[model samples]
Target: MISKSTIDTVFETARVEEVIGDFVQLKRSGSNLKGLSPFTDERTPSFMVSPVKQIWKDFSSGKGGNVVAFLMEHEHFTYPEAIRYLAKKYGIEIEETQQSDEQKEQANERESMYLVSEYASKFFQHSLLETDEGKAIGLSYFKERGFTSETIKKFDLGYSPDKWDAFTNKARDDGYKLEYLEKTGLTIVKEDKKFDRFKGRVMFPIHSMSGRVLGFGGRILNNTKKAAKYLNSPESDIYHKSKVLYGIYHAKQAISKEDNCYLVEGYTDVIQFFQSGIENTVSSSGTALTPEQIRLINRLTKNITVLFDGDAAGTRASLRGIDLILEQGMNVKVCPFPEGEDPDSFARANSEEEIREFLEENSQDFIKYKASLLMDEAKNDPVKKAGLIRDMVNSIAKIPDNIQQEVYLQECSRIMDISDEVLYATLAQIQNKEVPSSSRQGKQKMEVVREKPVTTPKVDQLYILERNIIKILMLYGNEVEDFEDLLLKQNDDTGELILEPDVQQSKVFEKVFLDLQEDEIAFSNEDFRELYQVLINRLNTGEEFEIGNVVNELEPSQSKEITDILMQEEQYELHSWDRHDIPVKKKEQAVNQYVTQTILNLRRHLIDRKLQELLEGIRTAETEDERTDIKNEVVGFNKLRTLLSERLGRVM
Candidate 1:
């Protein structure tokens, strides 16, 4: 387990802008840095990083958090993984507490698989550079393919010995259990014997977006007609090929910077393009493109230009992938190399400038490309032409944005010599058929109004007041304030009760805690109640208030809620009343008044709820005497509500 002090050190040392800026291109926007959201497809910037607050907020996706939270969300990392990542980034030496055997036994299975895969990657790389056989075969092959030593090292290219149990034996010698080796697909065990899975193949390590080795793709060097040329690791706990794209770790920054991604087909294609200066590229790793793969690219950029070889199979793959990209609401383009040249060969033959120029000149919009490719086959046959038109319309309907769909429909109309009206009608018909019966029923239900059941307004009001109080406590709980307390005392001469007000200085948290305790009030919401107790405990123990400290102690969902509260200021800051020349009261200036009103409102809400219960009891009373007693109780509660209302300056 990571020590609390180490987590705190990591959080303090890691700067929000510096961390996120490694993956995102952030331009200065006033006091914050703004960029397009890495989580969504958008041209305009809605993601803001505040260095002063050490937090970030993506307006497009409504995800906002501190540096560690960002890593957890973006990389799908566990809490420990995020902490370790930040610790490494900020050069903080982590101090961990020793765990018992039982605790160590409880280590996550996925993390274990990650460890084994990382070890295997290292083992393969070492073999490639250190072993004579590896150097003679794998190193020679990579060098012949025009891969530089630097490129090979950057991509973590490696080799496995041709022996059956070379890697398996080495891993066992290193004290790595054969169980995990088999789990990561590094070793294939069959009937009392184990062997390396990628024997004699040059290895391409596949990495997660955070650069952890998830799996490997190995290319066989020896010409064997019975064996496949390229082999990938089987699906494991840590690696799902459908959910991963090769070279995404290396290409993500470039993709976000260029606001476009170049999709290729193989590991060599990605490496060659990256080495040739087009770094914003990824491959499906030879698998047929899936929606999951397209969505992965969609997260970084809305535009995808698929680079295909001149072969007929490559063209067919591009056709299949284009519709999937459009389905995800991303713009798809096709860039085909000259006949007999793939991304690998083309990149190796051309200089960076020539490659860039050829890509620019050959790239065409997918809609246009599709139209051109299918038009020839449909010539002079009205039925075939009609089928082609329907195919185009189906692809058009996959687009979520109506404006983009309309533009494409018009383009299709101009090319196919059909009217836009016909295309619109066909799209409507297609969309209508796609709507499910349950969804239509839901729409109908929304259109019809139903009588609302009786609800406790006081309870709802109290919840809001409780949330506001907690928000204030989190923001300004440690500040000292002069708090007014109302006291009841006996008059000296008349011997009658009189209300006296006393002002006392105390921390805001202390004042709020005392006020709520005096009224015996507790938060109605369970989360708020729990947080309130934690804050009170911290205050009582003289712990200083820090948002990051509180967030670290919270569960992820609660942390997100706290982040939402903290980031509300940034969201509101974007809409400055000063820009409109309107007088707006600052929150700090009215802190005392706001706190007092929030407490009074909560008290008044509780009183109203008690009065309502008394009224209900009165209606259900079996005798007149019982009803009278309930009415008397209601009268006292009403008087308390009136007093609270008076304090809040409300006529009730």
Candidate 2:
């Protein structure tokens, strides 16, 4: 049997156009090459080959396939013969029969490239530690950056010697295929020439969450305007810069343990924080923060604290990334270093404890951080300040959680000392613009709706809230925990508003039942309404609620509804990542956040509907007293909505 690695190498090196060009006189036809059908007597060009897709089609003969398939069809060769032909033509080493276990492990092209990357990681580390040029340039740079020897080895820090073919020639000599080296972006191959992509650069191996090296981020140590300061592996089969996080392999456990992850901009920031004993840190590798990357962190923790450089201009430029975090349902905080300092510089100056303390004390939620940053510059100019306020409103509109959006708007109002009406009006305008919500980089849910000729999804907000309430009751109905309750009270002394956040321990069902009861609300969906009562009755018995027992008594449709409600969160979890892809330790499900948010969302949904009804009544009322009564009820509902908004943030 031909080894899978050999097959993969052959495929990688054998270009479809080049291989077919040997037999067919192909000519450029737009993006593809077109020639007369070789298998049939056709005067017009009917054989078309695409270099980009690496496949060919003979329209006249009705034959189509890859390079190897083409060889098998045209040259009357067997599968093995075609493989051998390409292997010999491309100079790829071919292995056949009696394959070793390691050779058997290479299943596909992507897997083979991964092995090449792993070897390259080791090669670079060896160069850093053993080579004279590597030690002089790379080792000296790290020492100058204050990276301890232990930290250096821990991160597998490495150096690529300053020569075009230093690493490339070595990789080839050691039986690592040039085809894979090129695919992994470690070597730039042109015609018959190839050279190391990161020559003369310090290599930081970017690892998958399972600790397998995916690619490299190479840093140029010298002051050279000719090259990028940092060069990343080009997007490949195994590596997507937007989807991977630097230091995530080392920081996953720490992030779940600490219940937070510190996000920075560069590789050294993560390395410095890790060395400073703050291992719960990661970087986007100098790229813009991405939702995929945020989602990668989301599996470990909901909280992300982004460490910003002291330069306010840079902060303002990337502050737009904060919206990505917000849209993905992640809580973001920002901590800016003192003027002219960054994570690397500050960590060098401060002790481990001071570094940790500084992060703790200085970190502010994104709302406060963004408002303060914009308010500073815009404060000096009235027109710019108006633009700043609108920009802030744009961010506030991106938040998916209604309660979170309301809370953020209130925060914005407090910071600008502007009335809540203005911000809320701007938010309403933005939300009602009829523009489809979408992201350019992501497989957007909106794009899916727009592109497919499917009926628009009818989202029932109230029904979703009801389903969520049932889900919460099903999971934590009998469990007791401290839940923060917001109570709006009038201060007797000064008649000022005082919101007291009372932490009360109660079973989850009790909290859900009482809140709905207090609001005089019932599930608008009959199924959820009926199921809610049944679950509450079971929970009220003071015995642990067994879903099995309750589900057994229900009708088939009701039972399925109940079952779906219980399993819904798992079924639609944002990050249902494969264990083989990245074995991230699972964080405990956030029972409290889910429970409280569901209840608040239910309240807001019901109240907003009620407010609309009251407004309608006020318009249609036949008498003065009737209109006055409706107006008073509207005031009461508005006040209640305000309290719910305050409780969303656990503050006024």
Candidate 3:
């Protein structure tokens, strides 16, 4: 466990903009930096980083937090991992509390597997550089493939000696247990034998977005008909091939900066293009592209230009990935090389300028590419043409944005010499056919009742009030203020009740806490209640309120709620009356009014709930005594509600 002081030091030293800039390309937007969301597929910039507040917000995905939270979300890192990352970035020495040996042994299994994989990656790299056979075989092979020494090291290329049990013995000698070695799939253990999985091959380390080695892919040099040409690590707890895109870790920053990604088919394809000055490229590692892989690219950019060989298999793979990209609401283009060339071969044969020029001049929009490829086969065949049109319309339907879909459909109509109306009708038919029967029935029933007005439940209304109160407490809780307290007293001489006000100075949090306690009010939501307790503890300690520190200390869900409240844009400057030469009241000027009203509204809501409960009791009363008791309770609650309403200047 990291010490609290060390965590605080990291939070204070780590700047949000500086930390996020490592992964995203942010341009100045007013006082903050704005960029395309790293969490969603966006064309326009919606991710904002505030250096002053030391926080960030992705409006596209509704994720916002301090530097640590951004790491946790973007890298899928644990809290400790995020902290350690920031600590390393800022050069802050971490001070951790010592754990017992037993406790250290019981650390997470996923982390254990990660440690073993990392060790294996280092072992492979050392063998490639230091061993004689490794240099003669694996290093020589990579050099022949046009990989320079710098590029090889940059991608962490390595070698596994041909001898079985070589890596296994070294790992065991280094005190790494065989159990974890097997779990990470670095070593294969059968009956009483253990051996290296990637023996006699050149190794490519597959990394997570945060650059952690998740697994390895190895290529064999020996040409045997029965032996697999390339071997990947088996599925383990740490690595899922379907969910990961090869080269994403290296290509993410370049992808974001260029606002484009170049997708290729193999590991060498990515390396070659990167070496040729196209840094914004990733590979599917020769697997069929999946939505999960597309989504990974989508996070960095919405524009994907797929590079393929002009062979039939490459064309088929490109066609397969197009609709998946469309479904994720991304724009995809295709760039194919000359008939005999692949990305690797083309990149190797051309200079950086030539490769870039080829990509710029040859890429075609997916719709046009698909049409050109399929139209030749459908020429003069009415049935085949009809099928092609339907296929195009179905692809258009996969697009979620209505405007984008319409634009694509219009282009398709023009290319196929069909009417826009026909395309629209076909699209609607396809969409209708795709809807489930239950969903169709639900839609029909909804249409039948469309005229009914919707009303929010009283409990939900109270919950909103509770949330608002907490928001105020978080934002202005420690600020001292003068509050007008209302009181009623009996005049002894005239025997009349008189209302009086007494002003007192107190912190906003103190006043709100005392008022709620006097009314015996509590949050109904369990999460809200937990947050309230944490806030109270902070207030009791008289600690300076730091949003980042508070957010980091809470659970992820609670932290999200706090971030949402803090990041919400309350000032609508675009619609401000100041533009028309009229002054409007600022929230800062009415802080007291806002706080008092929030409290009164909460009290009024709770009183109304009590009144409703009493009414229900009266309706179900079995005896006169019970009915009378419920009636008295209802009268008391109604009076309290009236008082609160009067204070709020609202009619019951």
Candidate 4:
């Protein structure tokens, strides 16, 4: 377990901008930075980062958080994993408490798989870099392909020895279970015979966008007729090939910075392009591009440039990914390498500048690319041309953005020599036709209106206080106020006034915070609980209570709650106007002040109600001591009510 001191060190050391900037291309927007949402595909910037507050919020998908929380959400890292990640990034040494066997067993299956995969990756890398046969075969193959030593190391390229049981034996001997090795497809076990699955092949360690190695791709160096050209790790708990994109871990930063992703095929293509200084490139790793993989890239960049080889199969396959990209609300451009050449060969043949220039000049939008590619086949056949036009419209219909769809329709109309109206109509028809058959069949409609929970005067009063507490949390959670003294009478025989100083030394937020702390009030929602806990801790540590940071720490639901309060229609301008030059009535300037006071009044009322409830509960106890406590609390609640009325300029 990570100690409290370790967590504090991570928070103090992990700069919000540095951690978020690794995944987002944050351009300065005043005191904050803005970028396209990493949680959703969008062109205009909605993901905001405030360096002052040390938090981020993505308005599109509604996910917001500090550095650790962001990593937890975006990379699927556990709390400890996120802390460890930041620790490693900032070079902080972590000292953890000892774990028992039960604690080890508590690691989730997915996490366990990830740990096993990481272990296997290190083992493979060691075999390649630390052994003679590995350097001689695997390293030599990569070096011969124009991959630098640095590039090989950066990608964690490795090789499995040709001998059977070499990797499996080593893994088993190192205390790794054979079941995990087989599950990750690192070893092939048949009839009590276990052998290395990727024997004699150079390894391409495939990683998640967060840089955790999920699985591997291996290319055969041998030309034997029996051996396949390439092999990849089988689908496992942590690795789903269809959903994984090669080089995303390395390319995410560049992709976001450029707002573009260059898609390629094969492991060599990814390595060659990245080594050539084009860092925003990823590969499907020779698999047919899946919607899931495209969506993953779309999260980082809205613009995708798919590089296709010259072959017919490549062109045909490129067509398959276009509709998927359009369905995901991304702008896709196709860049086909010269006939008989792939990205690897082309990048290797030409200079970086030349290759870059070629890509810039040749990259065409999907509408144009599809039309042009299919135009030859359609030739002068009216039937084929009609089919092609309909196909283009169908692809256009897949786009989610109305404006983008309209623009594409215009472009398609121009390219296909059809009318814009005709294309739009065709798109609508296709979209309507594509609706699910299940949705059209047997629909049972139940009109039910749930009754709103009855709100009593007590509840309303509590609601107001809750608002004030939230406001204080959002605005002045870190402020410390001097304790105020109040006089209270607590005797029957003598009219004696007891002087009680509010030794709390806390702001309004801190008062509510301390109350919750004492009661152990916990949020039921996971993300909300995390945000609430972190904010309280920050406030306690004398760290500035940044609204942005608190908002960012919240998960989507908590973000919505914050947004509803901060951005709602509670305040409006009071204006007077006339048709002529003269105004009918004077404009009011106290609108905002009134709103603020009303909110504060409501908040105070809520707190008073809660205090009253607590007092009443204490009174019901049969003990004299509890009764005495209730009497004291009653005084406090009365004083709170008096202060609340004073704040609103009302006489009690």
Each prediction's Cα RMSD?
Answer: 4.7, 25.1, 4.9, 8.8
* Candidate closer to the true structure by TM-score (higher is better), 1 or 4: 1
Task: Judging by TM-score against the true structure, name the best candidate.
Answer: 1
Candidate 2: C-alpha lDDT: 0.79
Cα lDDT over the full model 3: 0.83
Residue 383 displacement in candidate 3 (angstroms): 5.2
Q: Candidate 4, 316: how far from true, in Å? A: 1.0
Which residue ranges in model 1 land beyond 4 Å of their true spot? 1-5, 16-76, 95-103, 436-459, 482-505, 540-543, 555-561, 567-589, 621-626, 650-652
Record all residue pairs in model 4 with backbone atoms less than 3 Å apart, i.e. clashing: 64-552, 65-552, 461-606, 462-606, 464-602, 464-603, 465-603, 465-606
Q: List the lowest-lDDT window of 10 residues for candidate 2.
A: 577-586
Off by over 4 Å in 2: 1-106, 434-652
| Per-residue lDDT of model 1, residues 246-287, tens digit only | 999899889978989999999999999999999999999998
For residues 1-652, write the lDDT of model 4, one tens digit per residue. 8887888788877888888888777788767778777777566887877676666777788666677778988888998899989988888889899988899878887677787788877877888899999999988877789988899889988888889888888778877777778888888889979998888888889999888989988888888889889888989878888989999989988898889999988888988999999999999988888887987876667799989899999889888888888888788899988899999999889889998899999998888888888788899999999999998888888888999898888988888788998887888788767877675452322112224465643233333334434544565555555534233345566754343433335464556565566546544445445555666676777765556555645655676566543422122112221111111112452322333343445445456657868877885879988888877877877776666555445311
**Model 4 C-alpha lDDT versus the unseen true structure:** 0.74
lDDT of each: 0.83, 0.79, 0.83, 0.74
- Between candidates 2 and 3, which one is better according to TM-score? 3
Please identify model 3 stretches exceeding 4 Å from their true place.
1-5, 15-76, 95-99, 378-387, 418-429, 436-446, 449-459, 491-496, 517-530, 555-561, 564-589, 610-641, 650-652
Candidate 4, residue 535: CA error in Å?
Answer: 8.5
TM-score of each: 0.87, 0.54, 0.85, 0.75
Better of 2 and 4 by lDDT: 2
